[model samples]
Target: MPCDLEMGLDNNEDGNGSPETKKIGGVEEEDGDESVGLSRKMSEASICAAEDDEDEEGRKIELGPQCTLKEQLEKDKDDESLRRWKEQLLGSVDIAAVGETLEPEVKILSLAIRTPGRPDIVLQVPESGNPKGLWFTLKEGSRYSLIFTFQVSNNIVAGLKYANTVWKTGVKVDSSKEMLGTFSPQEEPYTHEMPEDTTPSGIFARGSYSARTKFVDDDDKCYLEINYTFDIRKDWQSS
Candidate 1:
């Protein structure tokens, strides 16, 4: 039987904005009247300094707008909110289940890469006798497509429910998530393109980059995830 390959690319933007700011680290800011008074005081101090002699330390201190303190407080709140959101998003996996040894119901049959105007390139893993590792060089500023195929075992009705791809190099690049409909015995091949127009453009660092794929069952109860690490470079080398 021919193996089924599934691929999908989602660039849809969803609302994951920062949470509302009401308090920070269990402490609320002063009331509106007090805050306004403090701001006015700061403004008055700045004006007074402008007309007075320089500081005794022999250097003049420049004060920004009166709202600087407020802006900084809001920024701190935003950073904390983002940190909590990331923790919740990536820490949903069960720790106890990590020790279980269970074969995946759905297996990755193959992973292939293709660049626009270029031939398709199939990657080989250790199981296929390529022990060194499966890797390919991706040129900067060029769009590449990835195709994923999966083999569904008997009695398994898994499907590609949610899919996302992220690029991490010290920090995360913008990514998209999609909710694909369920599939029965077998799922179709999925394809996705990287560096979509909306994606930020720049020279990606030349090193290992991780590509993660996840497949969930019809009920969204069980899932299988696979990660592929490959290299990207400015130019391809002949072996």
Candidate 2:
């Protein structure tokens, strides 16, 4: 099938939305194991699935209270992409940024998000101090991509040594629910993980990774900080 793929490049070490997800292209995969390895293809399929559902008014249909057709489509897309990326891209794809040194203009950071959309939401960073965070309303069950990238000081490694998308949910936006999805870039170079469940209004994620630090030969600056740029898009319907 033909599909549209989104690609993003983030210079920040912080896991924030800096790993921006943008549609890159359309790829048609031949049926077989080879198709599984092509993330660009899988993402295309995901996008198509998302585009398939919409009411005449352009709003997503709802089968249940607080549930929308858009959300369901995203849930399916996440599952399909995660499975395909793991089976196909893990060994062959190359994200060479994890091991190389970044330039002086770049920064390092990580990403975390909370659900429930109010004072009930929270964001956390496992590698650094947690800062006052921002909130984006994710339609229940919709698919959201967390594009993760890193920077280094030396060209030791080409890209990310490891990248993971993990989730923890709760009955009250606390750590009490099940982990919906987890993807690790261990088998290959380029891959995408299925996002965790966000349909319950209490599920969120942590996009975390490490990279080579850029430093001077002799300088007092010993710490690294990453910047996150959030790109939130809402169409006429989503609004």
Instruction: Let me know the TM-score candidate 1 reaches against the reference structure.
Output: 0.42
Best by lDDT: 1
Q: What is the Å distance of residue 200 in model 2 from its true position?
A: 4.7
Residues 1-239, model 1: lDDT tens digits: 00111112234423432122212112232334232221121222221222232466766544332332223234335466544432332233332332132222455566666666777677643343232443565655455555556544322232234344545563444333333322212234333233322112245355555555555532333355555555555665455
TM-score of each: 0.42, 0.22
Q: Which residue segments of model 2 deviate by more than 4 Å?
A: 1-129, 133-136, 158-239
Backbone clashes in candidate 2 total: 33
Best by TM-score: 1
| lDDT agreement with native, every candidate | 0.38, 0.26
Encode model 2's per-residue lDDT on 1-239: one tens digit a residue.
00000111221233332222322111223434333322222222222212233446777533222212122223335566645544342333233532222311212333333333433222233355323343233343333434222232221111121222212231111111111111222322222222333332222222221222221111112333322222223311133
lDDT accuracy of residue 177 in candidate 2: 10
